[model samples]
Target: GIFGARPYKTFYVENDQVTFATLDPNFKEAVKLSADWYKKGLIDKEVFTRGWGARDAVLPTNMGGMTLDWFGSTASYNSLSTGQIPGFEFYPMEPIQIKDGVKSVTVGRNTTPEIGWGISAASKNPEQAIKFMDWWFSEEGRRTWNFGIEGKHYTMVDGKPVFTDYVLKNPDGKGPLKVLQEVGAQVSGPGVQQDAEYEFQYSNDIAKQGFEMYMKDGNTKRPLPILKYSPKDIKELDKIMALVNQTTEEYMQKWILGVSDVDADWDTYMSRIQQNGIERAKEIVQQGYNHYNSVK
Candidate 1:
């Protein structure tokens, strides 16, 4: 597709500005392109209801074509390459430029780390919980969660963790994702940061190459740092965004699908939500950034 379909939210928070992408010239161009693609049937007809899972299910059977996905997860295509999909191929593509030289990959949403775990205040097994918590932060536990059983899931080469062929090419003809899932221990819960190195392991050659190429120009936009929020602040933020977010999603769907005219409807959409809850929410987010910077 000529357009990048991301940055879909009508609102974007950058530094101190809370801006509208619906009114952006570059983003409008992308929307126009997406609409054109939809008209041509080049875009999936069922895009609004369908997703990667649906596509993945059929792609293994050679029904459709390519899709954009996370760089880290792109290496899991070996499972689908078991000669079932005929011409199904997988590769990671570097960030591409869209109309007006808009970079496909940039400091944008979906790059932030957010999920975490916490113990209950009134737990029956406090001691067991404490022991497990300690183990989660341990190097050995992290290793187990990340690499799985070292010898079985991966091996050491020149003191670097090398994922074995069992992962690279599964003996049971399993795919990379399946093999890695079986062997690796996940450190995603509570206290562990995902080992960034494992993102490249046991994946295909093209994935590594693509990652390197994409990194040539740093394109990821990080979200605001974690900040303390009072319950009142949380309530205020939620109230502001709820309607705005819903309106954005609905309008976005209509605009992209040509249900509503992007040119005619965009301004009205912006104005409708402009003074709504957006400004105060923007202030709160900016305050979070400001607080984080001050502490740092």
Candidate 2:
């Protein structure tokens, strides 16, 4: 139900001015431009039908002489330098303007803490479970989980934890970190908090870049209103959302793959969505938003 329009972060040659149509622009112009790019072989043909990995098949081995990528941040550049594409170069672009003269980048809010843990209600040892949870959050536990045994997995670097060469290289077929994760020895639960230093100590350049991107773009984007719903409301919303999303995915794919003409088929697709009560769904979302705002 949330349908806020945003600009795309484009990767182009240095000093090139981007000219792609915005999401809310006239459909004719947008379709025409998109089709033109496809016809000219400038845009990847698989973009409409397949994902980036598949599309990468068409890229020249040397990346078609492209030196820039629209990535989250410089940290991303560092992280992505793995052996997948040896000697690949990446340059980050500043946020740019799009339609309606709006300048912004898209981002998602930080996930809530309770995203990944749950205790079975039928557990016989609930007290033990609670005690274990408490112990897991203790400082000693955090250090053990994040840094591993001081000398084995990591070493102290001026009092900061640094991964050993073996861990960094992921030397074995399955690294020590992966083994720890499988055993649930880390903060694998929702709502669990860890020290920022500990988190950063284990993060690679890609993670740092992602954090920088989020901070930078989050400061400029129009804030999305948070919403909450009642149980009944949630059930109804989920049902309607599934239908709407299915419809959107179908039509978007059809349009991109040239299976359906955008000009002639778009109105029909929109009308079908209207019949599915997208407007009512939107109203329900708005009500939730209003309620959440009121509580805030």
Candidate 3:
């Protein structure tokens, strides 16, 4: 919810135009609120310096109360920190509202799959490779890919496939996720439809409950589609947005840290962003998005 106070991305398409909502009134309010929270010691002091291992550093030590992370990772902490922290429990909360009647939408998966497989042109067994790929989409193949081999990783319970003790309770002190990874189940990439049963059987009761709670009222929405840009356009965009993003992040962090007053520095920041070619960056993004939609 803290991060959701601002726009999800630096740039997003609105009404077919790439928009930089950082300058919006709501975003300004969010930045102001963050500064106020930091002053009141509400926000974490080490948030910026803690780096990626912040969760490992704070969560297990009982230093952090709550974290805004993925459902699986967050919920699993309840089990992972059982002995280290006597009563360490992480419950998934409902999406918080940014304003009185405006509920925030949790960003879900992307519009299109990110991973895919392809056959090489120089492959000797091209026909066999194609046949194997086609079989992966078949009913039995999907089941195997999602749930692993029957009687080995899972057993037929009544009519549905249930994970065996090997997956649910590994003897090597490894979690189900690790075991699943080792055995090559529940790791199917794009183009293979994952079975819901895998999730149902793998997740704990708390995780399952959280899943139902979050998906109840269209509380989630996919972000922008992965836009494909021409080679030249991509190079141009990379050059422009990289510096723009750096400036944005620098100012945002400084404001949140109360190192600089947002209101006082707002004009200077805007001038810097303008000078950084933010307008040109937005145009490139707009063109890419339009081209993507047109092709689709």
TM-score of each: 0.76, 0.59, 0.70
Ranking by TM-score: 1, 3, 2
What is the Å distance of residue 27 in model 2 from its true position?
8.8
Residue 293 accuracy (lDDT) in model 2: 58
Q: What does the lDDT come to for candidate 3?
A: 0.73
lDDT of 2: 0.52
Q: How do the candidates rank by lDDT, highest first?
A: 3, 1, 2
The numbered model that scores best in lDDT is 3
Candidate 1 runs further than 4 Å off: 1-6, 9-25, 50-55, 75-82, 85-89, 108-112, 120-134, 149-152, 155-162, 181-191, 218-223
In the range 1-296, model 1's lDDT, one tens digit per residue, is 22543465534555566554544567767777777888887777777877535545645566556676655555465446656655446676656766455667654333334655667999999889889878866887766677767788778899777777776666876555555565446523354656767766754677777667766645554544566667898788878778777878888789778798877986787776675667677677666656767888
lDDT of 2 by residue, 163-282 (tens): 676555555533334534544545354456545554455556655664576466333443334456789987987787677767766866566556677779767866876777666676
Per-residue error (Å), model 1, residue 149? 4.7
Candidate models: Cα lDDT each:
0.65, 0.52, 0.73
Minimum summed lDDT over a 10-residue window in model 2 is located at 9-18
lDDT of 1 at 201: 71
